[model samples]
Target: MSAVLRRSRKSPAKDGPAARRDIPPGMRPPPLEPMRNPGLSRARLLDMHRFLRLNRVLEDQLSALYRQGKIVGGLYSSLGQESISVGTACALEPGDLLAPMIRNIGSLLVRGVPPLSLFLQFLARHAAPTAGKDGTLHFDDPGRSIIGPISVLGTLIPVMTGAALAARMRGESRVALTYIGDGGTSTGDFHEGLNLAAVLGLPLVLVVENNGYAYSTPVDRQFAVDSLAERGPAYGIASESVDGTDVLAVYAATQRAAARGRGGGGPTLLECRAFRRRGHAEHDDMWYVPRDIVAAWEQRDPIDRFESFLVEQGHATKGDLRSVEENLAAELDETARQALGSPYPPPEETLRGVYAGGD
Candidate 1:
């Protein structure tokens, strides 16, 4: 339960649906119903709004760092697609595993990766979780049940499939979830992983973020099917689609899917229909994307849409949303500043993990 919602339910005067009953008899409106299916509490909805803002602010900061030549490599942003990751991560339990792609910084944060560690990875600092061995958002924390993304596009699918199988063998009530791009679905590993998971009935969830393009390649050129979820049926897996811009909708779908997986059902494929508002990486101009396409997606911006929903539903006020942005902005600012000051790995540490030593 969310903190605010808990507080509200404790008192009838200030929160929940009952508080609105104080309006004049003629002015009183119909009671606001809780969201269906997942039934997320008011506080959880507000937290989703906060995560959406944090994801956007963090990526925006990374873009600025890249332009200033402060970051070591290409900076990838999930600019228009924050809800999928944040929503899905919110649905997961503590022991559940996650293998997120480049666009899943929101998921990492939701899974407890500190803002400073994320910036440190971008800075390629010795202080990073990966100790400068890997640049970008490619660090893993197995102890935390979060594995870093592999650069080989669809490879993480198979890697997570292995984890799912391991969980089943260990009799653990854990599901392994992984993110992949629309382009990644064409990879052999994607098929192999999903196929194996279906055959063995592994608790795996595949989230395909179909952001319209595979870097520069458009979706029409990539697959014949109109929706990526369509491919799930062929693999004998259940699948569904959701409005990627709506945080509550995404959370509801993911929560159901994750529950199904943990309940001994096979994998589920969720195709999130969203657009990448930025280039594949900061270096590309994204000139290939149509201006009208970008404009259309901008209007459906996930954070903005969710914030509006929260306010319209009386769950959060404009001031409440603004407070979230301000807090995250300050937090991200300090995170970047400290990361920029962190040192690089020393030459002596270069070969530390390169080879095995004899016992």
Candidate 2:
């Protein structure tokens, strides 16, 4: 994370004495326990670490560019919630579909989106997936089975549900995964989509990122239920809440959910409990969040926690992790330069793709 975006008052170690001091008693995370190996090979574990680091560092570079007035639109940072995206995405099979929200950029990377594509998209260069017409993650790669998110909240739930249904009809074993925020779960689309998926036993996994707030509204005000996972029972499907800060736990949960979907067990709802450490957008000042809460979550930073796990479990050394960071920094620097140098689409070219079969 960049210094410019680090608003937390203090950065405490994950298991240090000061870690939970500022956090509310009710909101405090449980004691840090040793994470069990999820049966991943040493190489795979290191790859997960690389993705986690890349997710954070890439956003840090974008945050810097946004501050310098280079990026075309608002940038959303998934700083503290990196684990959920990386963990869930890494569990997928080759042909599984992924529908990622604006904050789920890490998923795109895990699905093989080059960092250059993101930089170009954000920079609004002519080579971007949207051809410089749009400035956000409104582009998708069919080759990678990534469905770009629609701006309307909760809309992707139904879209991915349809995709899952289509795959089943075609006799393919592929599963579809999509995400929504805590506030988005209140949308009618969320209910309708999940209900349909349950009824038909479609291979769909819906991940609800319960990141404390939906924009500025806290989860408490958004729903009366004790936990979002409870809604799964109402729909007659399985549900579970996992520690979003723990990558291994999230990976395990997603693997089980994916397996259930593939085995004709219907959709599964996973509530990932994590906090959004930054504002909803780059322009918004996070005055709504209490400082102590942000401080507390910062100590549980997903990347930092994952790094510690890799070393403790003998999967990687400190030097190996440092090399990953250094290599990623260099790669991002080159990507930004290339994006900056790319030209924007010509005015006449804009009208060319606006309508089909009209030139």
Candidate 3:
């Protein structure tokens, strides 16, 4: 046998006995069991379901705001990529930073940004996170320690790389996570950013959320590789391809990746396999998506997949799931409604933070 194959299969116990051990009634197997491919625990699975459900609630609220004209300008929203946000953010400590993309509403919420502030930002209202400057996108959150949701595509990579470099210099071990789409992977800044992170061994997490499309272009048309996860090794970073819709899978992979970063092991590249259920933006007609293909990926919706996982793993009952969804919806609705009733940013303070290190 080839060396790689032999090493991968040299389990202490035989494949049959070890793999087919009978569990006692309802009890599930332990998580973190070493294998060729690792899986998540029942608890993790339950958490994932809750996270995505909450995400859907938030998305609904945002959609309502847009429909009501309370939300202004472009909304580069993402409804289906909830697992990347929920899974990775859940794994972070209090002080960690998320340098996000335009579609990272879930990441902001999970990182402890107030839902009201998120709504206000969407509305371009005063106290709108960015003080009404940013429209329908969030970035300014001192309370949550989030740096941004840069709208100009891949430019955030270099800025995030610098942030990670600064953290390393300041002796702060907090990990900085930055997202790149499959399309962003080809940008010069992406390469430059990752190259520096790897060389400096910066404590950073680089997540490539491969949702099969970047804007409107499919992965097959953009790249030759099967998974974006393969790019990590080129930068000498430890990496993995996770089932992005399964929040548990994303969480497990991120936890391991973050550990690799903070343990002085440098950066870790993670590819989150997800689907873009919504259009590129509200303005898009989404004519590029084939009807059959959309239907197929939609069937594997992350939130639904996770609910089944919860039931199959015996982590949650139907009532428990319902309660979680109900509570989250109520909370999100309150936040959004309150935002609608709130005041806008003062016109006098319009030019506030353009220049830093001053009052």
Candidate 4:
């Protein structure tokens, strides 16, 4: 009887499955909610700089791996979109969870997945945390709290929603945040996940990294909405839009939304506007991208913009920036070297981890 009572009390109707039906009529919630003054500071900005710089270092190392043929398969890169992942991860506490999309290699690093381990995972070494099942962004360290990439486009949103629901039921203060591509924003799972999160008042943040393309298809052909964040309000969730290239802006916006969720204010949708600098994957020539558009976005390089920001504000100098760049390069080189020695899972070991008890 005591156990039953405890379980019942834990999943309270006030904030769980049963309470959703009671949403009052005439609420007419706004379709978009902008985060006002994300509360910026020098310390915050410097961290953003480091994240963007680190992304550049890792991306370069990844390319070097490609050149050396260490990467068995090609890579999918988000050269210009580093801020979208790192900023959101920065706002999170140690226990907070982030479900990143394919482009969030930076998210893995920022969330405390060791750079060496990530490189090994990408290399499919036996030492990989997934034991070689996950390559790159597909799987995350459960210990680090990144739920999944699962790679099937928006499928993990529902999984994350389920996790958030369970966390809320257990009276846990944790929120589950899912990252998705602009292409994913149109999926059924995305809609269903947002609706459920809002209705339950579950702590969740759905971050849509809108980089203007769905593979080769442009955003105009992909969805009718001008802002992806607007979709959140259909289910009574708050929403915000941020400049994805501006690392500080992404950090600030995500920080606010995460704060609100942590305080039980429920889910928020953040639409981060940025551009992908390279092909969807390593071998994709990216010929479909308009050269002019790519050129314009290159001018808005987040790292360069942040470096200028730091220097203009007297926070750093050309020498300081150069030093940071050099140091990042050294670290990435070290990791890449470490990956060279890591062993691949032995062949015929493929059947391992395939079933619960080795079948």
Candidate 5:
């Protein structure tokens, strides 16, 4: 069996009776075992660290922008789930394709998307990826093999399955990876896409971010399955559940899944167990989530955990990490300034690219 499958079956029981017994009933699961280092080099580990920090910091800045009324649309904050985005994206090869959800901005950054582009996109600046036409994460960078997200949840599964099929037909060794939230997994598109991928043996990987609540609804009310990973076998695919807060574990699971897909083993369903610390969007106050759950997840903050790992393992010093953060803070400040200064699309150009050959 694959590592992902094995991990899913034998996950440690630390969170069940011992740690979280006094906590509320919903969203409680066994605590994740400490993930072994995946043997990443010092530089790569540092890069992962930077990506995790950048993901949080960038979102923090965007939240500030939203509060100041500078942003055009709803701002989604991936406050507590940075590892799921960064770790999985970092596991992909150069030619692999990934479709990022709204909260997976870290994946975009890991794929070399400049912070300025995100700021521009959110600010509705002219030079944004959508050319100021859309204010959300609806832009794609084909050059970097990053597919923009569709607004409908779970729809990207079929889109990415098709992309994987196209790559296979073209005789290219590429894998397509996409993500869905716990709520999205219940959608028809999720079932149809995963079924097709399983039947056709497409080089695809589906990451299910089971982040506690599906927009205020707890996991107990979402589905009857004890673990979402169980859904993989019903579709005849490999599946695994990992502590989404552990960046190394997430990276390792994705790496195995991607390798299996590339090696013609078809699709793998990866369930990343995490907690969404914020509301569905910035507008939400998350009144439904229990305070105890929030406090527990905050203690497992992915960035803080990874920072300690880097320092304890001698991969980086406190000063080194501090410098990385300082530099990133400076970069984001400049990027936000430039994006704010950019011009918006003129009225005449509103329909310029709306029709074919109109540009």
Candidate 6:
């Protein structure tokens, strides 16, 4: 057997069977035990159900617009990977910082980016955040503690590390939550950011969404390491792996990591294992992905998985889940309609916000 295969079978501490075996009868095993220190209440679980469905509906609507050629650039959808963003975002406080990637629309929404704003950005209308200057997923609002991501992979790690440093300087008990792809862990900036964060003892939580592809390049071609979280220990940081599809597991791991960060502990590397059910963007046909691989991930679809967990655990009923979905559908429909109706940025206004004038 290959070394990579051997390493893949070795479970991390938090994801081991012992940590996950405490479920009651008829309940499926959790990827990780729910943390009591910051356990999720029934109300919070309902809220999570709402966020998960909200993200799915929004992404589906965007994809529909893309298919209709209304969207300007490539459209990325977080179809199978919604839970990681929603779960992690819910674990954070308002004062914390978040750096969202192309596939992190859920995280942005959870952090309070209105669906109207996202629709406007996608449509490149007059009131779009970048005034149509930016062609893709780039919308930053520092006042809301969210940093818009750049196109470059792995770069946000350093940006988040710096934000954590600044928070420390300001005496804010805040942590910076940043994300990267499995393929992103190969980039030099990933190492540099992590090393610096470790050395400076910066309060940062780095999430690596190991979705098994770097735009058609499989894990075998990306790196020799079996798991991306292995890089954490080398940098003297706390690290673990979680089932990204399991919303509760992701939330529990993130809650622990964020608490440690706020308590003067340095960074943590959380490798979330899941699969991206869509192409790198809407344009790609995903011909390279094997049929069986896609089929397997489909069985563990995050939203479906989480919904079942909620019902089986007696936290919610099927009707409750249905009501949440029904409510979000109306809200999303109204917001998207308004965004489309909004005016486009006038051609003459392109350079208005380019330079900062003396106030």
lDDT by residue for model 2 over 1-359, one digit each (tens)? 35524543343444333243443332445456666668999989888989999999999999999999998878998988999999999999979999999888899999999989999999988899988877677888999999888789999988999999899999999999999988899999999999999999998999998887777677667887867899999999999988889998899999999999999999999998888888888875665666678888888888888888889888888999999999999989998998899998887777776577866
The per-prediction CA RMSD against the true structure, in angstroms, equals: 13.7, 5.3, 13.0, 13.9, 8.4, 9.0
Compare the candidates by lDDT and give the number of the best one: 5
**TM-score winner, 2 or 4:** 2
lDDT of 5 by residue, 231-340 (tens): 99999999999989999999999999999999999999999988899988877666556667788889889988898888899888899999988888888988899889
Better of 2 and 3 by TM-score: 2
lDDT (0-100) at residue 247 of candidate 2?
91
* Ten contiguous residues with the weakest lDDT in model 2: 17-26
**Superposed model 5: Cα runs more than 4 Å off:** 1-26
Residue by residue across 50-155, what tens digits does model 1's lDDT show?
A: 7788888998898899889898877888988898899889988979999889899999988888889999998988999888888777988887799888689999
Using TM-score as the measure, name the better of candidate 1 and candidate 2: 2
Q: Tell me each candidate's TM-score.
A: 0.88, 0.92, 0.83, 0.86, 0.92, 0.88
Model 1 gets an lDDT of 0.81
**Candidate 3 lDDT tens digits, 1-359:** 14433543564344422233442111111122111113656565566566677767887878776767666876665776787888888888778778778767778767767677777877888767677877654465656667876666667777777888888789888888878887788788888888888898887788888776676676666777767778888888888887676666777788888888889998888988776777677655455555455576676666776666666667787889989999998888788778888888778776677789543
lDDT of 4 at 342: 89
Cα displacement (Å) at residue 5, model 5: 42
Better of 4 and 6 by lDDT: 6
* Error of model 1, residue 118, in angstroms: 0.6
Candidate 4: tens digits of C-alpha lDDT, residues 95-154: 887888778878877887778877887799888877787787777667888786776888
